[model samples]
Target chain A: MSTQAIIAIGVFLITYAFIVTEKIHRTIIAMAGGIMMVLLGIIGQEKALQHIDFNTLGLLTGMMIIVAITAETGLFKYIAIWAAKKVKGDPLKILVVLGIITALGSAFLDNVTTVLLMVPVTFSITRQLRVNPIPFLITEVIASNIGGTSTLIGDPPNIMLGSAVKELTFMAFINNLTAISFFILFVNIAILAFIYRKQLRTSAELMANLMDMDEKEEITDKTLLRKSLIALTVTILGFFLHQLLHIESATVALTGAFLLLLLTGEKYLDKAFLKVEWTTIFFFIGLFVLVSGLIETGVISKLADYSVHLTGGDVKSTAILILWVSAIASAFIDNIPFVATMIPMIKDMGELGVSNLEPLWWSLSLGACLGGNGTLIGASANVIVAGLAAKEGHSITFGKFLLIAFPLMILSIIICTVYIYFRYLI
Target chain B: MNVAYKYDEKLLELKETANGDDIEFLITLFDSELKKRLIKVREFFEDNKILTDIHYYIHPNNKYQIIVRKDFYNEFLIQLFRQELLQEIKWR
Candidate 1:
């Protein structure tokens, strides 16, 4: 191999190692690597930033703002109570409800936010019911990964994939629903069934005393509540309108978020914005630059050739290969960067001599999103869920998360592969 | 600015006094629509007997910051009220 290629390989491996050990925070390491890439002269600063995918960044930031606003509504805690009650002293039902709501929420919102909103509630409910929160929390981790796989804005990887190619519009995503949703859903449900059959049957009450917490909330001004409703209703309507008008999702989300800030006249607007997680944005920016280093150093073309050879020039074969590999690798390393690196590689697969691998894009998207379930580190969404749940003292250990997440991830990928081959590749 | 000066006496000092992780969540402009929507959610909580962890608010200054988790400061709410008083602000 060439010297530049060797050096690039070294950089990738080092990043990979740090990610796996996770002794060093991934965000810090990523930011440092992003800086290193620029200093090393591997890529120019502007070019590196260009790779950052502002659209994805904007979408995430916008949604986070919305979540920040909505989280205050007592919506999540209220649901937590509902889940605890519905389980009706049944541990299994609690597990199922956690999974279902997580999936649904992740579909509309990003997975990390969904998990962030749910985890604390999950912990408190489980703690009150005197049942282990581990299983229910883990199920949420899996469900978020699976459910977030389908939508363009649901997961970071999908957003990356969307920006990687402009032709892959928001509408195109919904149009391809058969592959993204139905395909992923069946596998998700199957995995949940296999893991929680016994838990579902158990009569262990996980949240018996949770109702008292719900009774204390006072609502004195009925009029103020009415105004807030108008803002929310208008926001949803704006989202659809923007989608049709081809306005970026980020713009729509940000508009909604800012509008709320104006309407409420909250004293803590800055605090809410501050809570938006700038670290996550920095991670994406740095990761984008780091991946650009690979491309600038001629590493992308080389890897593309290798990937094409591995699939033996068959599109179907390449799709399956990319899908499975992405799914597996993402479980161990964060999928956003992994998927980011693969986009150029796959784009090259078809850009040159590797014909018919066009469908590989969808494969990668499906793989990266679904792959998030295999390990806590696989997706940022998983890590946040794990971290947040742990903070709530529910103790979602890496080992336990993987124990549930891995099998479900594998099954979901298998299902995705089948659906893709029949619907697109075959 | 059309300053619509409105304040809930219960939280007049919210600008200075803050306590509990959830105290910030209680302050915002209820105006009619938001209150009704919140009532449905409250009823849902009431039916289930769940405790209120945070009070909801919609900031009129920046409409996107709906569901404010912080208490409404008097100064800020006055500015929002003044917004209606201001002729330039248009409500869709």
Candidate 2:
């Protein structure tokens, strides 16, 4: 390796170490590493800028704005309270109903936002029934991750993958992963029910208390809710027709955000824009530059060559290898950068005569998205839910979360492994 | 009758010149609202058929003294002064 190549690798490793340790803010770490890559001349400024995937950033920001406005209308709270009522305060029934809502919500809306809406109301319901909120929270986290696997806009990793591979469309992601995601979601519910069977029971009086709550009171702003919902529906339609319209997903998302801002009145523009997770966006930018350095140094191609060699150039073996490795690595590390780095390597493999790259992309998608359930820190949604729980005095320790999460995560991966094998590898 | 309320240290003091029946009604309203908003208090209300361990001082100076528990005090005040409830009671 050349001196510059060695420096690039060093910077990448150090940045990854910081990310994994999570002592410092990930955005800061990523930004510092990205700057180092440019300063070290591993990749020039323009090339680094080129590497940043604005499509993914744009989608995230736009969706965040929509969610922010929608949340302000108390729509998510309304859904949660409504789901709680539907179960009649039956703890297990509440689990299943809320789990499904979370899965579907995460699929359509992003996972973190879905959980942000679901968790507090979950806490409220569980507290009313005198049950531990851990099981429900854990199930929601897992469901969010699985549901996020099903669509281009569902999860950050999927968003990254979708933007990186132009051929991977909105419907393509839905068609490929939705069934598997639902399968995993059902398995998740079963496991949670069995594990918490003792805690998932409540009395008639508790049910009566819950029934008395006026769910309509949860809707803080009905007019804003209507406007936000319309904008969201239009945006989703835009995503579906983007291919036909020859428009980018980013443009579609930004249009929806701006339209909602206008419809909801220009006064909310500042609050809606502020709701965008700038830290996350900057983190993606920094990660792209660092990975771009690896690409510029030919490290990604060499790694792809190494992977090809290990699989003996067999497509099935390569797909399984990527799926399993991505699953395990994503459980510990942030999957965004992992997917970002793998995108180029997989592309390199395609150039190196890997006939079918579609299966590999699917494998990466399933593995990375589902693998987030393995640990508390594995995904942004997990950490946010955990923090919320702790603030409410129901702290979910890392060990406690992993005790259930790790086994369940492994089971989900196994299911994914089988599904990928049958659907693609054969 | 006029009613004045203030938070001092860990206590919520209410000075009411209302008749006993009216004061009783307000207390009931306060308890129900607390049960609705604060989960901890709701759990207590469910277990015991009354508000949990709520102590009050019946004196001229502190007409009603609520010994707000440290944990539930913040939520207690939040519920008592919530805009909608305040509007309903014409306190806002």
Candidate 3:
């Protein structure tokens, strides 16, 4: 009830409201809030600096650079063409194959990058077959979220969680969530397939035409593709060995990005740098300071205490509560700040004598990742894909996307709930 | 036969001339010409069975730039405009 605490809460609420409304650039809102927090004496410059998670920022920037360079190589296009050929242009088959590819790609790479690479090609292939691209695009968005839940580096929330909880390793994430992610992917595809069954039929001639597409022709620069692929591979390998090698994920990612840049020569340095999303990075910076303000003011501790009290100190109930709450909240708001705030609160539970925090972490990851599929505005990837679709004259309205995606997202979360109960709660 | 068009690997730039010597008239003529070319390009792609889409942007300086996905088709369109069609269009 201190004035400073009240002011910090007020600032956080206003910033979050603007972010959800999306009336202005979130980066601007967040930066403004962080500055307000500092100006109000809620936190000092040094404390705010400590709040920014540079590892998460570095990893995001590095992956974005690599993806930007690799995207130009037409590798994504090539994969799309190849997948279309494999399905022989059958609409349902195309959906399943492309969904799996997107899911897998998102598991290893960022979801936004995965979708950015996939959506245009999906549009082109679907257009060629004279089918609507909406179903496939929606499926990809859902799959990207589910797939991203499977690994430490797959989604931003997971990355934040992994960076915060040192005990959570790359292998730990893979072992814990990969199976559930695949399960959700399969279920998601099946649901989409049934919904779009009528559109799944295409003419034999169109199938022949798709099969005739030369995937190699999609590659604009084979040399750059090779180099980018090599860099990505090394970075992934580095992630697997990060615990053993004593290297941070950010270091691995940045090294890989720079190595690829060097290998490709300096001609692309400027363009690659330009491709890094500075606005998103700044948003993260602002959010960190804002959340740090809550932590410093004892507000987060109070919330943690209330949550633990609500669950009556039972780990199972607490994990389940976190799962559902995180899922529903993330469906409407950006999960990054939510998770950033929740991490400390969850850690506080451990500090308050709640042993075995692994399940809580998994629940948070699953809910935050899969819940993003509930609405078009739920995740950054979803919004961008919607924007791209609209630009291409096939706009996916928010209600239309939510109609299909929300139920499917809930189904995925239900599956996660089951996995958490059987695998951890029992 | 002396009409000139500029060609690059991905884009074909066509310059417009107006008959009325009025800026508004010139802009209208340019827009109509751009629309006509876009229709033609669409028809051409339809005939050729090309799956790609055409995108265009008007430069700040009033040059009409048409972009195509395939390099070969871009070159082909440029050549077709230069050799066969450019001189037949009215210019002022």
Candidate 4:
């Protein structure tokens, strides 16, 4: 092993440790690690810059801008209230509906943003019914992660996968992962509904009061809502057809963001940009460079060679191994950096011996995304929801979340194991 | 705005209007002490992470408008009493 590779490994491990401990802000740690890679002569600054995946960043930013503006129109709140009424204010039924709504929202938007939109409404609706909000919040967190597994643009891991591998397009993700993800969502929510049934009961009078709510009045601005819907529809449609349009996903997303800005005029430009989650963007930037150090130093190839040898060049075993390892690792640590390192390793595996990489990619996506439900700190969405719930005096303790979510996460991986074995491994 | 609950006619006045599913409260406080209490009420909700339930708008001449969601009404009143803005809350 070269000295540069050794230094790169040291930097990456230290950075990973700090990120997991969460002693300091993750953004700072990741950025510092990336800079260390450059400063230590492991990777050049320009080479590191070349490694940054702008497509993922662009998609994230565009969707954020669209959601930030759309939120002003009160669309998400309106939908939640409307869905609650549609279920006749039954807490159990509303639990399922909100889970489904949250999943759908996360399918199209970012997971954290979708949860942020859902959390407040979940609290409002649950408070109105005088039921405990913890179950509902837990369900949404799990659902958001599952939903984010279904599409190229849904989760950061999947987004990074799509950008790194050209064959894994938006449509390809929908075709391969969406159905399985939804199936898992149904199974997970059903169990949640059963477990929380006792806590979900409400008085008939309270139910009646919820029924009397006027969902239409929740729309704060009809004109802005209309414009937002138009832009959102076009952006989603663009994702569906980007492959045929011969355009990159980043272009589609940026075009959608700019189109919305144009429609709303200058008033929304500043607000929309301000809400773009620049910290997350920079986090991705730093991670890309940090991983590039491993790639440039040939460490990824060594790891890939070792992994391929361990599996004896069998695609089926390699796929299953990757899936299980990703799920277990992501359950405890940040999946973004995990996936960042694994992408190149998997690519190297393809070069070394693995003939079919499709199954491997899907397994990675399923494991990494679903693994987030294993703990409260497993995903950004989970942590955010827990923080908000704690602030509201409803504590979702790490152990409490792990007890419920870890078992469900194991069940989900079991199902994925079956799906991958039958659908791809066979 | 229709008068919903008036703690004191001269010092604190609360006028309520129903906007869709939420109750918009237009609170006018002639006394600065009442204003301080109202600010505390806002902080309580904010601290609880229920930000959308209340909005505080400052106007000239010490006028304030706070729109609260109907779901948070009871809790809001409880907070007012907790802050000593209300001597007691009665069930109507």
| Predicted model with the maximum DockQ | 4
A221-337 per-residue lDDT for model 3 (tens digits): 788888998999999999999889988889999999999998999888999999898998999999999999999999988888888888877899989999998999999999988
lDDT of each: 0.65, 0.81, 0.81, 0.89
Instruction: Give the lDDT ranking, best first.
Output: 4, 3, 2, 1
Clash totals in order: 66, 0, 0, 0
Candidate 2: TM of chain A? Answer: 0.98
Select the stronger candidate by lDDT from 1 and 2. Answer: 2
DockQ of 3: 0.06
Against the true structure, whose TM-score is highest? 4
lDDT by residue for model 4 (A142-165), tens: 999999999999999999999999
Which is superior by lDDT, 2 or 4? 4
Every model's DockQ:
0.03, 0.06, 0.06, 0.11
For residue A11, model 4's alpha carbon misses the true position, in angstroms, by 0.8
Candidate 3 chain B lowest-lDDT run of ten: B19-28
Q: Give me the displacement of residue A311 in model 2, in angstroms.
A: 0.9
lDDT for model 2 comes to: 0.81
lDDT of 2 by residue, A270-304 (tens): 88888788999999999999999999999999999
Candidate 1 lDDT, A157-218, residue by residue in tens: 88787677766766666566424664566556566666666654432322332332332233
When 2 and 4 are scored with DockQ, the better candidate is 4
Tell how far residue A166 is off in model 3, in angstroms. 0.2
